[model samples]
Target: MRVKPLYFFTILLLFSSLNNAYAFCGFYVAKASSDLFNQSSQVVMVRDGSRNIVTMSSDFKGNVNEFAMVMPVPTVLKREQIHVTDNKIIEHLDSYSAPRLVEYFDENPCSPPVMYKMMPMAAPAMKSDSATVKKRARSLGVTIEAQYTVGEYDIMLLSAQQSGGLLTWLTEQGYKLPQGADAVVGSYLKQKMKFFVAKVNLKKFNQSGYTRLRPIQIAYDYSRFMLPIRLGTVNSQGQQELFIYALSRQGRIETTNYRTVKLPSEIEIPSYIKTQNKFADFYRDMFRTQVKKQNNKAVFLEYAWDMNWCDPCAADPLSNKELRELGVFWVNEASNKPQISQRRRPPQQGQNVYLSRLHVRYDRHNFPEDLLFQNTANRENFQGRYIIRHAWKGTEQCNAANQYFKSLTKRQNQRAKNLSNLTGWNINDIQKTMQIPQRSASSSNEDMWWKDLWSQ
Candidate 1:
């Protein structure tokens, strides 16, 4: 069977900035996206056993007619296996998984500790004249396995005996194959991989009345759980940012070929981040700093949680229907129905789904191979959670209040230091930005204690 190549779509570096909201736990500030870095791409992969569904969203800003994508497939996909889904699903997934900033306020130390519990949430139709093209392809050692029109895309499944023939054919088809792509194509050919090629059907796209191209979804069964990203790196872009959202039935998914490190989370950050839309910038800078600290050789786990519940939800979890729409085939609606009982219970929070979000800033040097993934039994929940503790500003005359006041300076200084360490920002600049008094360069412990006591 002929397969499509995985290089048809041009990677667009787009980022998303969400509006901030106040949740019961804290304020849900900005969330991070690929836009923080240039040349970013997002992929949502849903896997169960040997079956897999992959949805790819592109930020292509070029003309629709020039839009094309090539994907490597384990098997030739039938027309029914390919689909075009709404972009919102992927956006929702991004928002749900993106690193988030949550803000909290400290209660007055003088006040009684009231224990208040707060809970917070495709294929195109083949033409008869294509028979001549088949004969021509055979002469060139290429096979067109399948062809069909699905939604707004015309897709083809192709298999090649050699890289040269495939490259020649792709070039003739107006694909503008990247330089040095032949070697990579040959490697896939050696592995017996098939290529899936797709191009936008202009007539269909125009008639569909869609302003933007929807994400492309493909379903197949392949035991090798890996994503082919080598072709994307062939471009001269310095570094590409990729966000992979993996959903599995077992538990959290992680990269096996590369180190999968969790991003720093639940740490208190400076409160200035919440004053404006600086949360996204802070996240972006912190991520870059972390990546640099890792020497750009690791994949960062931004979020990994059971779909059932979130401590401080960035966005609501995907519903069963939405999960199914995203190619999560294992979610059975019947099994998810509420149980009728004498006492009505709150609806279920999460189903059997588990999501893992992996962020990587890769280049040809650091990530020389495509990503290989494994679903682990580890179900421990993790999120790129940053905290902002707003200091109590009320004046209450008490011994506790005096101690709280005395520690305020220390806390602010620590916050400044944390922000500096996280984002690689200058300590002086951070203190200036926070409008906190700068500490004397030569101040000693004795001087500081006296300053703290007398200043207050």
Candidate 2:
């Protein structure tokens, strides 16, 4: 009886050693996809039949997890498992409505940050055992990044971007207020503030049909690229508070209620625009700081926004003469709300209706070109003489958008090289190359077209 009990204990110990050496048994990788939100790349995981959990997401636990066929890549499997592998790549569980679970496609995926989740169950023991070596292995930091860029847009929406930018314009013009001081104050403060909303509307759609692709659309795409957002606010005490949100593949999740307050300021608009002293510039600067310092391990950068802090901007105390010329955007004045034609609407509804002139009217010649150009004017102005801020609405469309870390892919770069093969894009005529989408509609326009040789 004593010998039998000892023999049983000895056999169990041997089995346990063998099991530790080999790893997980029976449980398989149920499903895997890339586009799913909240994804991980450092490790794979699965669940056991009796509701026990297993994981592949790990740095060595002083034991080899991969050897146990844990979340093994399809390439490592035998022919019998090929069909299962194909199913994983092609199908998913509860993926349709779950944005986090969809396998996002990217020629280049973001270097998502390392994520660690503890599994509650252990692997079963094996009968055979083998011994090898032991040593110290350095733990590595892992990051994952996924980007959803349907349309192309730049990655940063900074002070260098337009003042009539979505945040600016929306706060300025998008709302209707109750008739009183609270509403007035809200309207006044909103215009100077900034923040990235989860949903963005291409508000200019009705205004620009053939004139150009609406800039709000570009801004929308730009936001999705995990572009940084800056918000400026002011408190009643004339204190400035800037909220900056960083873009990650995950949505902007900040620990503070920094986004909802007002920050007071004593700053001038034109002078402020001239300098990078605007509140939004704070987060914009932080964004440059973060992206410039992104580690090599590509992490999923899903949705990131940034903000800037500020006191309510100082009030303009200019006389009527100065307001008329340098600042025609008179607060005492009203903005004209032009009516739209059916051409602006989509093909489906009310397309047959004739357009109406906007009920509002104002003197175009008296327009504040200076105010509009205070932040928007540039040497890189593409449209004939007029930029987007002020002018007869342009007929030429401007569509500049992008996705992922940067816009230029190896394939895109190759296509760029092959570009000369397909068309007469003369490399020698440096001043006259067209960057598709809005290519030269006329001979003279060719000389004015601009294309950046680089994108991120």
Candidate 3:
């Protein structure tokens, strides 16, 4: 474990406004993956009433022996309440919930237009410690409630009477905490929260033969539905990126403290974004623009839909078995909810698992409080989907074709403007890349009648 206050152990999108009337087919092309952000963490939270399961994964690129995490929890988790989960499941969920780029090809106007649509493809326990450790902990007003070596981690549940004592104890035990964490830890201590600390057991880690650390999951029945992110933000160099995948049996999850704003979605952008790394670049810059637009105080909702199916899926939905592993204990529960619509398939009943993806970019100055979440009754489906329309490339010479080409000019120019507005990219630059001339203030639809006469 890299002892520099395990930031890795911490559990922790803009919309475009070009609303075209064309039918949207979720055609998954590319996505802004979580790895794009260097200082980022991913957390999967499954909530049903007071029962909450939180799985935290970190991208810690450090020595395994130097890794450890100190988390604040409402209750002392037993050995059975903690376990290690496969990282792939979280990756799958990340890809599934990530903001994606979808494309639509324009139908040839000379021929009949068919509705082009694409369908989305779909723990152990531990024992007590030695007497010397107990005596030292008691002297520091800290109680070692429980200890267990679950999987490759040596876990400890602690209740501290004061932050000073806890900090000293942690220092003595080699769990290096970041500076300025004293106050935050003190606040949680005052709230009657218990500290769940874990460090890798080198023997077990070596025996397991895994190159990277698996995510640590904790399950407990508590009334508080909040995640302690303040601790993770302490001693930060700059704003940190956090992707929260919240799953609930009731409905979507929203932050109670901060504004939970849905990112601009289902909008159209320039077709050139489909080439090379433009989509990824477009997403990253667009997200940065939204962060600035919201002043970095808003939590962005990237995706919220029934997990039963996804149209233009970035990845297949997690199986019930995977859901169960991620702490959706009620995945097997029967429900009367109608199945979400899918292409060429009958609507079957759903698993009632509504997953919400929330992206937050924050720092100590902006986000002073840990994220508090609530499950709402709203089940409206939404996604951060950007569309790129490929104009008709045929050279047929009909009146319908002429009208289509005329409409294409306006569409292409509007898309350029949309891209500029969303990402703050220069309109002239976008048009240049699209190989179209910049639309001037005096430009009109009638003036562009012959723009696309022979080519796209």
lDDT of each: 0.70, 0.17, 0.72
lDDT of 1: 0.70
**Where does candidate 2 have its weakest 10-residue lDDT segment?**
5-14
User: Per-residue lDDT for 277 in model 3?
Assistant: 49
Scored by lDDT, the top model is 3
Model 2, runs deviating above 4 Å: 1-176, 180-255, 258-456
Model 3 segments more than 4 A misplaced = 1-38, 115-130, 333-346, 438-456
List of clashing residue pairs for candidate 3: 1-64, 1-65, 1-66, 1-67, 2-66, 2-67, 15-264, 26-312, 120-312
User: What is the C-alpha local distance difference test score of candidate 3?
Assistant: 0.72
What TM-score does candidate 3 get on C-alpha atoms?
0.84
> What is the TM-score ranking, best to worst?
3, 1, 2
What tens-digit string does per-residue lDDT give for candidate 3 at 104-135?
Answer: 78888888765544323210000004788889
**Which runs of model 1 end up more than 4 angstroms from their true locations?**
1-7, 10-38, 113-129, 334-350, 439-456
TM-score of each: 0.84, 0.12, 0.84
